[model samples]
Target: MQKTPKKDKEVINVIIQEYQKNDLPWYIGYSGGKDSSSMLKLVFNALKRIEYFHKPITVLYCDTGVENPIVTTYVYETFEKLKKECKQLNIPLLFTILKPKLEDRFFVKVIGRGYPTPTNIFRWCTDKLRINPVKELIDKDVKAVILLGVRSSESEQRDRTISKHKTDNEYYLKQSGSSSNIIFSPIINHALEDVWLTLRYNELPKSIDFNQIRMIYKDAESECPVYRESKGSSCGNSRFGCWTCTVVRKDKSMGNMIENGYSELKELFEFRNWIAEFRDNIKYRCSYRRNGAKGLGPITLEGRKIILDKLLKTEQLSGLNLIPQEEINRIYELWEIDEINVNYQEKRLTTTCIKHG
Candidate 1:
């Protein structure tokens, strides 16, 4: 282990002070990435220093179902280890895996509803998949504090956002879209190196394996912002998101992982590329909107069927259960409903023509 820097110590002290300041339950947004991991490490150290636990500290991990399988497995395993270790250490930390509602799942919207995969303009994924689940849980509390791994130095837009939401205290910021919740970033002042130092040097919580996380980083890149607090906030080339994500022209992150020895990603990568190209093909799209407007709409029923077949084939080839059986049942139900609607419309049109003639 490397030497503990004075700056990391200062951050941990600050965390301890803030944690003791209120009885409010704390929610830490964890993406299982380096930044969040480091922030969590600091939190662990702070908790260790205190004699009494004032309130609950819940670590929230959002599993969108579409997350990279490799990362998903890592996070799940880590959670198991964390639960056991925290129990042994007598740390009153709670670990929760939050998930989007079934209807809001990625495959449900895309394959079941025939909606296209998310793009820059129609990035309907972020709120439904990542943000809403967390918000739903947090809002259940009358008021709470949310700790995030956000740093101003990550981007200019982020810097501006931090500046805009600046509270009297430098460590806290106004939580966007909610008056009941406040945002606290313990590592607000930490640079990239500082983040790594926090993770590597912290000895508590014996659950986290920094080297394993580092190995993942060596293959794939950084996380996409888990929560979109602001309207114009970017996703930051998110690697941990849905394997089927097509928000970017190409998923370079997955590609890098594949090249770096995660060969299992090849089929998923091919499928993602195929879906992106297939999405824009007019033949596969409805000529009219779902509301009967004369404009381009969702993928046609035939297109949806083709995509599902391809997805199943990919799942079989990759040996990964990409879609749940529940989702498949829902998709079939939706297809039946859509077909009934189409037949009803055709019959009505035929009757009108006969009457006019």
Candidate 2:
């Protein structure tokens, strides 16, 4: 057996102490990325060293449905193996995949309700797609500790945010807008190399292919937060998000993944590139806001239809299920509602103009 490093041992001991501190269920926010993977590994080792399981430790993964297909497949497969092996090993770890509500799904907003693709200024996808689902689940518990894999070294913005949220314990943080639950980052102090070391050294739960993660990282370098708490935090900067993300001027990571021979990403990449440009085309957007105010607003009904058509075409070309059938149904329902509202607004304007004339 490989020996654990002194730092890792220290962190694992702290994990055990924290685990045994109270009856509060522990929820680990896992993204299947290096930092989260390391945190999970440390927690797993801590559990192995202990004798009795008093409280539930659930691992929560948010699947935005639009996550990069490569990472998504890896996570799904890893979870299957983890479920089986953890049961055999009696680790008592529960794994759950959280998803956005139908109305909040990416396509439902963009293609159904005519939401323009998210730009940095108009970014709305993170809250609806990623954070809300996790928040809703955590809210069910009276009080819980959320374990995230966020690191201070990722960026200066992240460092400042972490420092601002500091709790009495350096490893813990107070979650914004929530008084009930607190955040715990096990690998908060770990540098980037330290994170990789954790994955490299701690090899238990062989279900997680650390090597495969390394290979993926070679092609795609960064990760979006699984649970976002602060506005200053990092996301969608060459990290993974919806393949259709347009917030970043360019999605260098996905581009790199394609160049690195992830051929499956080719069609999706092209479609994303097209849509990023497409969202900016004024011809596809309504001149008035959804609220009837004069401003650039949601995509026009015709724009939504065109986007849906192209999305379907892309789906066929990529051989991937880009959007779920339920989302499609919801999109159509939203379209109906929007069409009625648009007609009503037009009629009101016409009536006012005739009276003035």
Candidate 3:
């Protein structure tokens, strides 16, 4: 390991002190990205240095079920290694993976219910796939502190939001119709270069491959897939998001990753592009919203069936189970119900017309 800088040491020391002082359980958001990786390293190091502190520290990972295959594998392997190491060190560390409910799954919403592909304005994926799952866990814990890897230097709007919600050692996150939770961003002030340097110099767990992470960074530019809009930038342009994301005009991250030698992902990339094309065509989308408004809504039933067939073909080509069997079953059930309802409505309309005539 390289020598740690004075500022880095000071920041680590502050983190240690805060962890020691807080009695509340700590939940670190691990998105399997660079910033989250750095934050976890700092916290883990701090805990290692402590003698007998006993407040539980849990790392929470929200698996959207649509993450890049490479990232998902890396994160799971790293977590398993961290669990083993923490056990050997007698460190009170726990890792939990949170997943969205079946009803809220990507395919269930898109293909099952004929929902349109997510767009910049109608980005319904984030809340259902990412935030709500994690938030559900956070809400269960009373007075818990959630640690995030967000950095102020990442964007101007982020800096302002961080500053606005700044507290003594954490930020306040207001949950909808629920009590607020505290969020601590230890690396909020750190620049991008500082983050990379820390990851390079710090003695991270053996499970973490800094070099692999560096490669991913080189390819993707940014980590988290969920889009966050900033001044002159957006997550779609720079960050790693679901391969099937249609919000961005282009999925540069996945394209770069393929260019960098992950050729197996080509099928997935092509499928994502096809989804975007399908969503853009007016013939595939419904002319009215779910509430009967004259606006864009879910895809038409025929469009949904076509999408499912194509998706299944993509899965076969990619050699990966893109959608879970349970989700597929649920989608089929929904389609049956939709068909039944349509038939019943048509019969009822015919009967009423005969009576009136």
Candidate 4:
């Protein structure tokens, strides 16, 4: 018998191979981004071929909770349409929405409790907002295999030494020696052109429309924030997230959307800008440092001195909803830690995970 050639494996075919596993649950890390969409298409096609196994494949959408309404609506609609159609066709596809804890949202932490915005030197949200929640979805009982959309072409950071990756010629898994969950990227071989060509050619069921997504991706100018590398030119669309991300200096995406007349996003945009300004004001933080006395650990990031009184002032001035007392109390508790010598960076995650509207 001749062995099947690895290069001959189509994206959909590679994904279909997973269906042979009656034991492990399949997890797709769908961020609703373009590459992820292409991966999603392959997954959809593959699952359709498995007529015998009625087991539902989990399509997990890690909602930042602050995603642009446009993307948010598209993601939900696509999932709903697929869920209904698959159920009707007896295809057994289940869509689940996963999100970072509410307190982990940027607005909740930064605007509510004055946690500083995320930066390259420190990105506290990845685990809580992107990676961790997805891991929880995999659960511990099974040999979980996750399907990630990441391709080597996306960024230099992603294009590390090939040996560092776990690819058997055609696909790469996120596990690439990092994450604990077993993950795979089937479209790792396909280029941007192939993905677009495939999407353009595939006559998707009427329920699974990508019209809105097409338009948004057309005008999108930034990369996805979750895995986006700092100091690189923006790729993909919408700054890797909602137009409201304050982590970047001046959210070009949100401003562009507003220029494009997504005026409905006005509230969200204003909220983001306010958060950026609050982060810029280092004086609102503790000059002495998070520790009772600051000597030196990591240098204090700018705007580490903002206190609660000013946070209230920012609430009044910026019209942002005030932070809940629970989160403020949490931040205060964190401040007591002598090890918190890193300034605003140290609190980014802790505060993001506690600040509630």
Worst 10 residues of 2 by lDDT: 348-357
Across 279-339, the per-residue lDDT of candidate 3 in tens digits comes to 8777766555666556665676677889999999988998987998999999999877766
Candidate 2 error regions (>4 Å): 219-221, 231-234, 342-357
Where's the lowest-lDDT run of ten residues in candidate 3?
348-357
* Residue lDDT tens for model 1, 244-325: 8888888877888888899999999999999999989887776666665656677777778999999999999999889999
Candidate 3 global CA lDDT score: 0.75
Per-residue error at 331 for model 4, in Å? 9.7
Q: Can you write out model 4's per-residue Cα lDDT over 1-357, one digit (the tens) per residue?
A: 232223323666767765675557777767666677767776666766676774567878877655676678888888888777777767766788887766675445553444566665545555556655666657563566667666667545556633355556446443533344455677766666666555555544345445655666765532463332222412222364744455566667666777777766666667667656665553345444333453212213223334345555655664544455665665555444423433333454322111111
**Error of model 1, residue 37, in angstroms:** 0.7
**Model 2 score (lDDT):** 0.82
- Superposed by TM-score, candidate 4 places the C-alpha of residue 274 at a distance from the truth, in angstroms, of 3.5
Model 4 lDDT, full chain set:
0.57
RMSD of 3: 4.6
Per-residue lDDT of model 2, residues 103-155, tens digit only: 88888889987788888888888888888899899889999899998777877
Q: Is candidate 2 or candidate 3 better by TM-score?
A: 2
TM-score winner between candidates 1 and 4: 1
